[model samples]
Target: MLTISRTLSLPESELVERFLRADGPGGQHVNRTESAVELRFDVAHSPTLPEAVRERLLARRDRRLTDDGVLVIQGRRFLRPGAQSR
Candidate 1:
């Protein structure tokens, strides 16, 4: 299960997490290991989400949101030479 808040939580089935290769200079490890996480949530079809929350989410103008009301979130972890990137 994925915890969204103290009162609201989403089920594991509703939240899909996929790992992909992160882009950056990290030697062969970067090419071999998938460090990027892609989280996909079906806001329009998820039964766990309330109607008001779903409507509000769909009403927002977000480029990550699809026409089908699926929210795609990509989190990348890349290695840099210094702390400048951080």
Candidate 2:
């Protein structure tokens, strides 16, 4: 479970994570390692989210929110050495 706040938590089942090769600064291993992470959450259909929160999240104009209402977050700043495949 992922805790969003004192009262809100999202189930791990609702999250989808994908790992891909990250660009920049990993020496020769950069091309071979899937160290970057993309996390996806279905805000519009999440049963764990409150209706009010879901509506508010969907109403936001952020580019990370897709037309299908899935929120995509990516992290690529630091690469883990020898990160294994999922």
TM-score of each: 0.83, 0.85
RMSD of each: 3.4, 4.6
Which 10 consecutive residues of model 2 have the lowest summed lDDT?
77-86
Model 2 Cα displacement at 73 (Å)? 0.1
lDDT of 2 at 80: 57
Stretches of model 1 off by over 4 angstroms after superposition = 82-86
Q: What is the C-alpha lDDT of each candidate?
A: 0.89, 0.90
**Best model per TM-score:** 2
In the range 1-86, model 2's lDDT, one tens digit per residue, is 99999999898999999999888888667688898999999998998899999999999999999999999999986645665343
lDDT of 1 by residue, 1-86 (tens): 88888978999888899999888776757679898999999999999999999999999999999999999999987666664456
* Deviation in Å, model 2, residue 24 alpha carbon: 2.7
| Residue 37 local lDDT, model 2 | 97
